[model samples]
Target: MMTSIESTPFKRLDAEGRLLKPAHKAETRRPGRFGFRGEIALTIDPPVTLEAAFATAEDGDAGLSFLAGSLSSYKQLPALVEALGAEVKADGKYFIYVSDLDRASRYQINMGGVPLYVLPIDDTSVYNELIDFLYLDKTKMKKFDTAEKLDVIADGAAKYDQAYEAISYEEGLKRL
Candidate 1:
């Protein structure tokens, strides 16, 4: 699976669960999961498209979703897609929810060589909200170096206690 295209240090993961390997600072990979001890939460952007959402939700192998219909079925999903009501990130048909921790051990089953990130929105739930991003280790996932900032980490902060190296698309080119 290794290749020259993935060897560049700038490549990295974006916040959309996609690979941007060779990505510079400020660039980010997408998140894969957001759950508690046995639960998770997810917040997808707008461009993913509704059909894509359904495809993501219906894909039996993705293992990221179970059977969420609303934001309140946390106790219903077997172990594929738990639902919650605390989320609020949807446009026309998109929605957010918490992963049922009890039934979330399936995420690792189909991750397909991607890294996962977890951020703390309230510190109390470090493994449930504010996902960092998922990507390939050296090629697609290791772009930002959030290890030197003091303000990037907010009140709750991520569990790592280090600042994420975030750079804007414009500033990223400077390093190239």
Candidate 2:
């Protein structure tokens, strides 16, 4: 059952597990299972406020506020969130976990007929930490693009020669 508003480009999906067709970037779409949209690592200026980021996701049409608590169960979450320890507000609330925001953005874009938008707050340290945590052991889950491949290559430089040697000449040439 497609709503009239879902006709918008960002809201379009070919099937249950297919990628949402955004207005731009038609070539980047790839079929994915488990409603895993994708993750974006934000870099901000001064004055960072992650809770505001969560609030933005919450205000999205997908009603992402509901997913906040469940995110505590995601992999790597306990350690990261627990490490926050006493840094959180007196209310003990924050958008420290990226999984919730990522999932919520996916939900809105794929199922709620909403455009994807995330406001980046200022705080490179937190942003860097989020990016690092989001992609931990991520190769086992998602395919990497050229830039990401470069990142992997850079991060795994020690294994580069071995990885290259493991591939046949023809395969290496094809990759090149």
Candidate 3:
């Protein structure tokens, strides 16, 4: 005769015998243009980790969808939103994250039909970081035109690297 060992409720052991906690269900937002939709949790923390930032971009079926720039450039977000007549909802799918709240700022933009979560990093480090993260060849980057470079960066980021914490568009502006 054998007796069954009752495990803790709502908890399970992984292959390595480590206890696994239940996954938290993030709040979902409504669909956006171009069939964009997914869970978007509100995060007050600034994105200090690449994983957090990249997770936002990975939401929905589109995979990685983001653009990055400096705080000065992020200032244009409101005007762009106004031009599009799109309201920035607190729980909206459009999320942005910055490296530093006091200095860095970021935003989101719907270019053509794709929703891009724009991130803000130090202007001085943007190019260097991109080059390193993408493992981009300087000679190739130079040879490529402006549009081509943008494509390369987008493709590379989508493939590799990912952020810290994310906040709403309005919240980001207020911090700025």
Candidate 4:
């Protein structure tokens, strides 16, 4: 006779560390007598994604089972991040582009306001490339193409301005 099932309370979070919903019950099955087995069917509101959960964890405390696992087991950060499916960039910084509202909803990532992608900018080229690839093309404003390639130059200046607040290049690289 089973009195109670030992379960881990699972919570959902977005990439920006926002609590998407309250904690839900999740249980792992254990071997039982006479081939009797138990299973847990967990239906997360926004669905459980480690990437979203991790992004949320990075920002602050978000009640997520995987984040809890990563914290409790210090050696699992790399594995945990990998499981989150971080996008790899050629220059630096890990990024996840919120392509559409549907995908954003799945991860609970925001599309407007400040950029939701996480990463650091060191060289101007990398910063320029990132902004150009992600934001510029989506806007109605004119592209910054010029004979002197001034867009890159201007972007470099902006990157420098963000130096104090931006994440270190090495740290961004380590997120992968």
Candidate 5:
């Protein structure tokens, strides 16, 4: 025996017991209730990586998701670069590296097309050391000792370049 008018559109009330603005059907949607920004960000793509790896092999640069240690574990190199840039912003422990990527900062060390890798100090020191190897100018054309290692180095290098470009280090840190 109730009319439609009696049914209030406001499903919830305000603190003062007043009718609150009704939510639009669209606004109430939950496309991905558990979605995370970190999970769905623009990252280094694989195809681009393959292409980059072959194209920039001389420089050993590519951006590919890879493991810090085992092949099973993987991480987006771009995200690592972003995190490194953030850390550099918080603490100057690796200011020179971050500054190079930061177009606005001083004391920036332009790689002049050299590859870089800004990864966490993970357990795989070997991997980190290998990446450092790829950064060397002499071995760039040396066909990279290991295929897997080469792929990772290429990815890391790509990230290094990207990270450097995104950040604008505070002026006064550039080296002559």
Candidate 6:
């Protein structure tokens, strides 16, 4: 049986590395096999288009799946923002879905405290993106264990320093 590792709790930080207080609180839920059942409560207003990218592994083998698309691609994005009484600053942010399984992952971009952009990112997408960005060999990476893979992910995440936040699946609906 494959062992599961405890993931770090989600934390929000500012650009200067200072921790930011959570603007919203999430509700707790019962844990599932891989982790909590991945679900979100907040419905995307004027649904945006999404395209599935790839999966990291097969079933029961720590699968990470990805979906990619932009909120700007949606025709209703502006109307949605206007409905929310928010401005379009165009400052994009990344919202990471933090499930212990890592398989159920999605990202979002916020404008003026409103999450207006989102895309799914699976483990395969992350790995592929990292290799291309870092100039790493895919064949060599196939030999990596879980810890090593996590390390590589961390390195890649640090390089961009984008405004990103991680949210647990259990708390996502309430918090978002």
Task: Find the candidate with the highest lDDT and give its number.
Answer: 3
Model 4 TM-score, 2 decimals: 0.17
lDDT of 2 by residue, 17-118 (tens): 222222221222211101112221121232121221211111113322111112222233333233222222222112333332333221111112222112
How well does each candidate superpose onto the true structure, as a TM-score?
Answer: 0.18, 0.18, 0.36, 0.17, 0.19, 0.29
Better of 2 and 3 by lDDT: 3
Q: Roughly what TM-score does model 5 have, to 2 decimal places?
A: 0.19
lDDT of 6 by residue, 1-176 (tens): 33222221111111222212322112112121111111211124433322121111112322221111222233333333443231112332222222222333333545345542233334444346556644666787688754344444334433544333544323444443
Q: Residue-wise lDDT of candidate 5 within 72-154, one digit each (tens)?
A: 11123333344222111211112112212223332222222222333222333333444563464444635543443334443
Query: Which residue window of length 10 is worst by lDDT in model 3?
Result: 3-12
Cα RMSD of predicted structure 6: 15.3
Worst 10 residues of 6 by lDDT: 7-16
lDDT of 3 by residue, 1-176 (tens): 21111211101111222211212212112122111111122221431111221112222322224333322344555443432222222223333334554543334445444354566555445545566646988788888644355456545655753443445556655765
Per-candidate Cα lDDT values, in order, are 0.22, 0.25, 0.37, 0.25, 0.25, 0.30
Off by over 4 Å in 3: 1-75, 84-116, 121-129, 132-135
Between candidates 1 and 6, the one scoring higher on lDDT is 6
Compared with the true structure, model 6 gives a TM-score of 0.29
Best by TM-score: 3
